[model samples]
Target: MHMNTYSEATTSQLPIPPTMDEDLENNTEVCDGNNAMTPMVRKKSELVVVANNNSRLQMLRNFMTNLQEVFFGTKLVVLFPAVPLAVVANFYSFGRPWIFAFSLLGLAPLAERVSFLTEQIAYFTGPTVGGLLNATCGNATEMIIALLALHQNKVHVVKLSLLGSILSNLLLVLGSSLLCGGLANLKREQRYDRKQADVNSLLLLLGLLCHLLPLLFKYALGGGDHSIATSTLQLSRASSVVMLLAYAAYIFFQLKTHRKLFDAQEVDDDEEKAVIGFWSAFTWLVGMTLVISLLSEYVVGTIEAASDSWGISVSFISIILLPIVGNAAEHAGSIIFAYKNKLDISLGVAMGSATQISMFVVPLSVVVAWIMGIRMDLDFSLLETGCLAFTIIITAFTLQDGTSHYMKGVILTLCYIVIGACFFVLKTPLIGQSPKASFGVKPSFEAITT
Candidate 1:
């Protein structure tokens, strides 16, 4: 004979007391082992206890995370669950560009908001939380898109996306920032961020090698499609290991030799006054990213659907369209920074973001794609390779002399605008009305549409 119904006092005393965060706050019970509570109970009771414990543990973990955020910082929120949200959003079929555009806008505010949060967590520790958050969100969005592309076997599209993002950050973000900074002062000179520069250059070199190696290897192997993507993934993993080690070395050098480099960050004094602390802001960011990602996915999906109806190539879409959408937010902040005469920091942001992507994001995507049995190459196509080469060359030229001029900004921006126009009209020059399992450039637009 068992009492199925227990009194409130006894129930509270039972090991299976409710375990919600707020609900647990009221409970006076503490776990003290089998002696303190009944060891043998109904299986249902045991399940209840387990559920409560799990919830309590999660609450504790979140609290600990809050404490860490108080001391440390955070990453991009709108992109935290980008893949999942994108998958859902892609199910929608209209207004995709706006969705994607909204996601792009997420970058700037995310950086600004997170920086404020991290600064607060550190008790105004002097680092902008927004920088890392923006990068994180950017990386997350890139990878999610990469995965979707890979899942669809759009290898060329993936390369285009990578190149487009790099170019957007380099030319658009950097150029706009330089333009603003230059206009504020007739002449703008960049100071030496030697540590950051060295790391950036090294990563860029590594990324180039990752791109070059498999491409050359494939060309040597008669340029067959088979295993080209696979080989690229393997090389990406190797490069990731090398570059990660380099980053570790950079961190070590900063710690041991130039500690001030870690601190003495260049932040906007005005922005700082209005910014909230890290954890408080980060909590809000978590919610925002979710909403934004949802929106972004819808945007991408709708655009894609419309594109499918309009017969647009994903490669052209990524190269021209995605860039406009993705970097919209960060570009605004970069321009402001430039206006505030933070040219060096702007260059660092542009170059640093690209270097990190090439060295870390691309490689990690390869590994993750591999694990998921998706083929993601570490290499780029001829056009993509050409674009990367062009970007690096122009970037080096732009930053080489440590001076940024307004004319240069005009040049870079105009080039981007021209490219955008070409993309819109030429439309990746597709061919054939029917979708082919194996992709080859179609001969003409008429062939594609008909």
Candidate 2:
């Protein structure tokens, strides 16, 4: 009987003890092929071991099942699983610039996954960590594209894209968010903390001013004289360094000194409500970043080709198309939050991203160019500078009252459209073009630079 029990436990895939109970050993014997006797466990002892083994196995299986449910449960897993297929598609279509571009666009959703994971992590870590992570990764796509463009000495494209990013965030994304949120809450006014929003807008205005200084220095003293150009470049490099320091201080003010000012809610709760585990969030962030980097390379490689083939200016490509592509994540998040009536978070996404691009990413590009010996100056064209200044001031004006209506969104969006159209017709930039040589109109230095 004891032998039978041991045999049943073995066949049932339960772990068996090395030795059986002494009572069973005294009572029972097992025989090998040569009729050699071996000690066997008693039936009761074998049953006890089997029961414990089954319990352990059951617990492990349950744990695995839960893990599988959690990890693969999200609808986003559908996209994650397609990443391998996208990679293969990109490789197979390597020679076709259009196909490569299409594949790169497809990879954008995967990059957006990083944003979702960051939000999840933030939910658990609190708003500060979450906001910081979002800010860092928010422009990952743009930063990657700019750095790659810088590597190829495509400084013009980089500058255009930087302005494009800021405009897209300020006008397109923010406008859409406000419209959606206001419409969704049409019965009541959609409001955000004007005070917090104004701080960022002020910072944006400061950044825009800093950007204009290089241009002012160049044109104010006369056209890009070799010595003046040299001075402007040096000044730009210095300004970029200072801007980076200022950005650090701004972050300190927002996250440390006056976090409550930016908090979406009055409660100071630190409880984490995110469902994603730490390991899972970290893994996804790293993986998605790699994918975005690869996709950005393909996008940059094809940008000029696409622009030429489409008969669109490279500036237009960078200013409009590239910003839309790179900012896909934030654009989606902003609209989604707006639809959900989370206007505060929605506004934060738009305003905060715009501010970061202006203060942090733009300055970093200048510093990176200086480091790489690329003669990148912040002397934007008059049209570009004027558009930016006008947009920032108008946006600041809209935010001042703390209330957003769908009509206001329409107005902001219309302004963006007009500006985009002007850029579309803007002349392809000359290497040393005067400020007067712009899109059909020539504004004085005061109007253009200031």
- State the local distance difference test value for candidate 2: 0.76
Candidate 2, 111-130: lDDT as tens digits = 56667777767776778768
Q: Which predicted model would earn the best TM-score?
A: 2
lDDT values for all models: 0.59, 0.76
State the lDDT at 206 in candidate 1: 64
Per-residue C-alpha lDDT of model 1 across residues 123-238, encoded as one tens digit per residue: 44334343444555544555556656655555555566767878788778877787777778775464445555555665676677767776666555553454764665576667
Question: Which parts of model 2 have CA positions greater than 4 angstroms off?
Answer: 1-96, 265-272, 430-450
Evaluate candidate 1 by giving its C-alpha RMSD to the native, one decimal.
16.7
Query: TM-scores for all candidates?
Result: 0.65, 0.78
**Worst lDDT 10-window in candidate 2:** 31-40
